[model samples]
Target: MTSSRSETAYQRAVAAFKNPTLDLLHRRYAPFVVSVLSVMFTAERPTVPISDAHVEVGTFVEELRAAGYDLDERTLPNGTGRDICRSWARVGWLVPQITDGVELYRLSAQAVGALEVAGRAGGGRAKVSRSRVRTLLESVEQLTQSAETDPALRLARLRDERAALDAEIALIEAAGDELDPIDDDQLLEDTENVLHLSRELPADFVRVAESINAMQRDVIAELRRDERPAGEVLREYLHRGEHVMEATPEGRAFAGALKLIGDPEHIDHLTDQLQALLGKSFAHLMTPEQRGELRAIAKRVEQGVQEVLQAQRRASHVITTQVRTHDPIRDREVDELLRSVMSGLQAWVPDSRAGDRIDPLRSLPTAGVRHLRQTVSDPRPPTAPAPLRDPGEQAEFVDADTRAWGGPNYAELEAYLAGLEAESFDLAAAFAGIGDAETRRPADLLGLLEIAHRNGLVESAEVSVVEALRPDGTARRFAFGAVTARTLKVESHD
Candidate 1:
């Protein structure tokens, strides 16, 4: 190769390494990240609620810390798991999405690729197996026969396959019940090979989905640019929307996968075949992981297909809606203004200090006004001198009205207590004996207690209940320590 070619290849390699997939694996804490992600996400479960992911990641970190792992500030992320996840999102390892109105963390295509490599490295499969070679040979042979232009060559290939099948049939018939079965070792190897191939499907699906999303974003951006007429732009975008699944290589693969697994019968056939395989005598030789992978093959394919379809639908919907409500002129104007502002900030950033402040334009400046009032009239009263009213001329308050709203009638309660026969009586009973609703008011209870204390009352631990009436005609029951008036006396009216 020429020096230019070598440099070009090296530059391309460097660019590839800079991608998130390789960058993640190259990080210092890559093992930690991979282990956490692998455990948190699996084939059956792709997304975790944002809060749950944060908590689980935090707990895992704590466990690592307890396990004596070197997770210092330099070795580990600087903040809590939430911050770490946000950082991962910024670096494109995790994609934040909203599903069912809940924010979730899903492995991005790049993250999935990293995980796939990590998982394969630890899978303990043979470096090269007969099953792997056979699969490649069969695939290439089929491709060759399918691509053959001459009908004679195609017929010859079909004849050869038929001859081989006839021989196998004859051998089986001759063996009768003694037909040879595949060895457990070979069976396990083949299953593992199949699993190895299946593992790439999820990452491929994610790539397609992400590609479609990216295409939508690009289309919208181009529309906003208004470089072309609206009709022309809409036509281009509409065509993309209709053939969204064919927009990218990954999307094209997704389209082919749809042909294979989109049909219910195909999925059912795959499931049946898997079940029959598991029922074989050699199946027991496979690990639980292998068995599980085999069982979920059909389900995983369906899920991946659905995910890609949903992504395509989402893209179409977004692109269509953007086209319908598109205002190229306004969008272009806004885009230009934003670019200008960003350019200004970029220019100003080098001269700005960390603590520099700018008063944000929260609202338009107030209109200029002249001759505004600076002071108001004084709020003080005009006069303050007033003599007290003569007591004789004041109208007397009615007793009933006074009893309803005023504080406890000490004099009334004292007279009522004097009317009681026993020098010592339960305060509750005395208060209850009063027939006047006003006198039996809740406030009157306090008055009775105060009057009892003044006239010498004995307190006991025994409980007491007093039902008092309010002026609003509602009754309230209060419970307190028992109070018994002793040597009750009336005050002088001096």
Candidate 2:
């Protein structure tokens, strides 16, 4: 009797061959199927339970028909097309059975052996789907057609494909060019031919151009590092029949690489070479100032080198020394002495044509002192009398006793004299007393007469007493100098 498991397995196998999804499942399960068959065939009894076979087949198919393979849908095989069960049987992998009127199929022992052999050969898996094969074939055909019909596009594609060719060429050319002009270097010849071919060729030549240019740059950079003049390098490159200004990678790389290195010596040499070249190429191209500045920079560099050498010597000596003493006091003393000397020198130095001159007596008594001394020694000679223009203008001068005890409304003058009691009695006090009087007549007359009698305000009158009488009638001699307006001056002396 045919078991349900065997019947189910046959039906599943047939379905897998008919349906596209099932077909993908079959391909996925083929490895497992082969593995199981190998185990079965290796067994002396050569028998695999229908349930085990069915489980193995289902698991393998499910895995093979995963989303990764895009094999979800199933398309049924038509009547004339191949189906799973018939295909397996025809391939001698399975045999049909009719037991108890129930149809079933089982894997034949010979079929299992064949599967083992096929698995060993790594050919047990099914082939790819027909649709995918067809798509790939169609893509190849379209690509070929496009290449044939569109020349420009095809050339662009080629340029993209061979982008590095130019850079390589430029490198070879630049290196060959740098060698002392060779007679027949194949590399140089080849480079020239490549350049010429690239110019005429229809395919994109940018990549080839770039590569050659980069190679050229590398060559120039190497030469520069060896201390060759950049201009000389460039000139030699040009002499080899290459345009330095064109979009050649070599030329650009050479210039850029030189800039990157930035060696001062190389820059100086190159600058001079360039100037010379420019002079030859375009006479009167550079200004005199430009030339001068370049020379000056060179001179500065030489000076800097000398300075560096000297500094290095000093540094070496310092490094070798063992003594370490820091004397702040000594340093300060030296600084002070230096400062004094500088100050003295500055003092003696004439600031203008007038020479260093000193004021005659600016350091003498200040205004307050001089005023005090003058006030004490000689007060203003009363108020000086207005000149006696007319003899009639002269007012009669009266003695103190002759004058009224409470003099002519001189309250203000008396008050001023009272205030002067605290001050040093001198010319200023005398002047203040007389000037404050309500009656200027007597004061003015007295001041004029006193000035005339004493000859100067600062002079004192020497009074000699004939005799000093005692109350008992005994007498003695006396002498004194009175500081009065009698010793006054109308004008100050020089």
Candidate 3:
């Protein structure tokens, strides 16, 4: 009630606006955050994990920088869109949760709410239904009747609700299971309203978290100004922290909301209702962001409230800095040094132990690693590869017989062709002499010529009279049946 107390309370409330969360969302990263949230809406799930967004966020950051957005120098190369999202989580707009060992992000209830408000940003008026008024009117009536204190009024209101319920039940029974369906327009309007609420949740939480933080900061500032003893200041800090939670409007409402959000059954019911609404034909009335918010609403709210609680708890610290009061290592070393100096003073004089400073590190003796030479294999030595065995037994066939070994090999054909390499063609006797006629058969004669022809050694062949040495190894003239010539022309590949 005092002026000082009122000023302090006002300052705490103002701290909510001081938080950088709202600034980042609505100012610096507004376009990026909105784009991200909008993209997440395209997914069937509420969470937008980094796995699905590394490339997407990278590209977005690059494009934004190109468009002359004021991004940090380091962020341009590495793409800090993810870091920007993390900042939102730090401020309670997004819940940074680890599930399945992966850090995932979901829009907090506060973020959803902000999006709803911002949904109309840079755009035209929002589309609210005519039935939205009807829904709000009915909601106000229910809230007012539920809060009635007079016994007579409460009883009359309860009786009316029961009568309406009974009438609805009678109609359903009278219809023989053919219940009247809800009007499509009303359903569409309600669906849109639900979507709107889903959007508002995240934004609402942002306000709550910011307020809690502001109140926390105010508590610390007050304690810092307190001139009481250290113990008294700590106790006062604890007391003020507790009082704020109980007396502050933001604190009271946030505590209640956190409880409701954390309730498993409440979350399940909200999720189920949203899913059911989305499944309806009327779901098309909602925007992409609204649909995404509905899908992730339960999870975001649950985790986001927990994170907000953590931030508030951090603000409850007595001194807020451990380094200010003590240091275990430093104290022990100082105690030892004091004892040593005092003992020296008692034994001799203060001048004996006194010096500019004793460099503890300097007198500590040398430390070095010695490497001893040992017989170790040379790691960089060049080594030859193991000789590979041939593929072994390559396939061989001649087009004439379609059988293996039905042709002369390169060696046999090479020698036979070298003699005719100087001539176009010769009598068949020349080929006959190349082999032993006494042991050779007709197939041998045909196979030798086939091998030569296949290797591109033959150009043309004809039946002609020619003098030749017989295979019998005797000097005798014979009429050769066929003569062939080697191909004198070569084809160029290139």
Each prediction's number of clashing residue pairs: 0, 25, 11
Q: Across residues 167-227, which tens digit of lDDT does each residue of candidate 2 receive?
A: 7777788888574543333333332332222222111121222234344555445443545
Q: Write the per-residue lDDT of candidate 1 for residues 361-395, one digit (tens) a residue.
A: 89977878877999999998899969887674465
Pick by TM-score: which candidate is best? 1
- Candidate no. 2 TM-score: 0.15
| Candidate 1 TM-score, true structure as reference | 0.67
Q: Which stretches of candidate 2 lie over 4 Å from their true place?
A: 1-279, 295-297, 305-494
Model 3 agreement with the true structure over 1-494: per-residue lDDT tens digits: 45698898899878876654455454555656776666664324556676555556666777777897645643333446666555656766676655557877666655665555567564456576776787788999989987888999989988998999999888888998577678767886666666555554445555555565666665555444443444665676567666654565656666677676667788788878778878987668667856666677666676556656655665554246732553456655877888998986576654555554443545656768598677889887498878997653565545442433333344554455555545455436555556544223344455555654664443334554433333333444434445454523334478
Clashing residue pairs found in predicted model 1:
none
2 or 3: which has the higher TM-score? 3
Better of 1 and 2 by lDDT: 1
Highest lDDT against the true fold, candidate: 1
TM-score to native of every candidate shown: 0.67, 0.15, 0.47
Candidate 3 lands at a TM-score of: 0.47
